[model samples]
Target: MATMEWIAACREELYALREELHRCPELSHQEYRTSALIEKQLRAWGIPVLDFHLETGVVAKISGGHSGKLLVLREDIDALPIQENTGLPFSSQVSGVCHACGHDIHTTALLGAARLLSEHRDQLHGDVLLVFQCAEESFDGAASMLAHGIFSAQTPNAVVGFHCAPQLQVGKVEISAGIREASCDSLTLTVVGKGGHGAHPDECIDPVVMSAGLLMQLQTLVSRRNKATDPVVLTFGEIHGGSAPNVIPDQVLLRGTLRTFDNRVRMAHLAALEDLCTGFCRALGGTCTVTVEKSLPPLINSPDICQQLLTSAQTVLGEDCLGSESAPSMGSDDFSCMLEACGNHGAQYLVGTGLENDPATRMGLHVAENIFPSQAIEPAAATLVQFALDYLN
Candidate 1:
């Protein structure tokens, strides 16, 4: 079947699947219902399905008649913990959960592509693996899947995935050769001191004061320590300590995020953070504990795979749909784990699809409740279809 004919055959079914998935959104690691829905759809279409090591994710495989290379396509199957606010007809039915980050769209697009491929199985080469992963919101899902041996069975020659862009036009595609996203690390610091009466400042170590100093110093990690040329963000999002204003608290807690694109800079910044917090607390006659947890690594696209994606996107959507030199986003994705697992297997990952056309369209990241137009869905599916065919041919 021709690419357009295959896409047309599955367009309506894809829309229905997308809306259904959108209405019943599930958060990371809790995608039981979503998994069942996806499994059922793929089974009905006669694609062979496999349960993920993590119960919340699914993997399906389709084989072409001819012998060629294996290609893997992945989509995250999770939502965020945000209340829906888009007020669309098919807005999230789960009140405190939403597919605001367009994972719903991504999954739908993959499924649409799956249907198209299943319909044209005779034209396909080798095999195509459809990976629906869970827990992208937390950095752990992809890591967990890897640890549990998801990719040990079959490694693809190339892996591909895309994220929805709220800033770009709906159907447009963006490609970057390397360092497409920043490395993310979560940090929490506990400051300990002695509690005493507020009036007796000398009696207490004053954790609140210590916390303030630590926060100020943390900000300097980027300006003073990190290279100014590299992108770095140190943001303290939460701080908690004293119970009452009159009582000097014995302990204060600080939580924040560290983001950087360069690995060397990321490691150095983390080390400096620990050293600064330890020194400040010791000098202030208090105790401190700094725990840094590494999240996703920087998303680096392979040059050859990036070139293939660029060519395929231009062929499908023309040169106007291609994006140039877009800035790297600080947000991280668990899909980076898949890329890591496929190391030396010649895998490549790229993000596609721009945000809605209107400048006033206010869509929140990941968990915000907003409905992207259904029109954007078709072109994204079509793009993937063309890209997959190009890879196979």
Candidate 2:
């Protein structure tokens, strides 16, 4: 079968694989079953998997009949800590864990591409590396795999990967030139104060009050300190403190994230956040300690690689399916780590897997009601295959 015909023929198998993965979702760094399934599938296709040190990641290589450039195609295989409410028959059977971010689709699509590439390897020229990476949700699985030198001897000429985008319609793909994703830095703030009765307003140095002030102050780093064009977002999603209504806690813990497009801006924001939080707590007669856990860098796509992938996408999915120059999001991915490790020659594209054009039916990533269309698997696989073929040629 030809490229398109082959992808079409394997749609059922791809869907079944995706559903199986969805039903049996696994968390980051704990994807033993997921990794084993990928290993089994790749080995069945006669591909040679390199040695992997990470517990839940797998890396396999497929070489054509002749020698040429190397290409790496990666897929993240992990589920989020979300209970499924999608009401689908294949919904997560594993309680409190679901493939809400569509990693299931990503895994199945890459598996489909693997099958097609293995079948068409006779017509190919160069080597293709399939990386079924793990723990992309909260853990930096990509970086973990790289730290073990998974690709020390098999560096690729170019790399390509994909993510599921709910906003765009099915069969569509989006490719951006630079800063595809923002840099992510996690923040932990501890406010220490004297504990007393909540009713006694002036008797105790309330850390809860200090934490509230700190949260409000941090927002200014984005709104007042940073330039409008810089695009900075600081959001605190978790705060834990007091026990009872009348009891004032001795300490309050704040957890949040910092996202920025530019590295300089990211650093500046982190510095300002620490300084401001410390100052605020000190002025309010409380002590504060700010801990910043640095994560992946911004995912900036190489313009030359984007152009090549765009051409491949247009050819495979038609011109109408191509989305470019769209607004970049504040969302971050550990794929940035993969790109950096791959010599910064890779591009991660967004594949629209929404079931319909209507917004109501479209599901957002990490939401409890995520319903990624199974239809997108074939198109995504086809585009990725085309990208590899074109790059190798």
Each prediction's whole-model lDDT (CA)? 0.79, 0.86
Clashes of 1: 1
State the RMSD for candidate 2.
Answer: 2.4
lDDT of 1 at 121: 76
Per-candidate TM-score against the hidden true structure: 0.91, 0.91
Clashing pairs in 2: none
Clashes of 2: 0
Clashing pairs in 1: 168-355
Candidate 1 residues 1-393, lDDT tens each? 456556667678778888999899999899999999988989999999875556688888889888898888888889888898877788889979888788888889888888888887788877888888888887777787777677778777878878776656666777777777788888899999999999998988999999998888888888887778989999889998888879998999999898888778888888898999999999999989999874677777888887787778777667787755677778777676788778822323334434444432435455354456665666677777777788887
Model 1's C-alpha root-mean-square deviation from the true structure amounts to 2.5
Residues 8-61, candidate 2, lDDT per residue (tens digit)? 887778888888888999999899999998888888888787886668888888
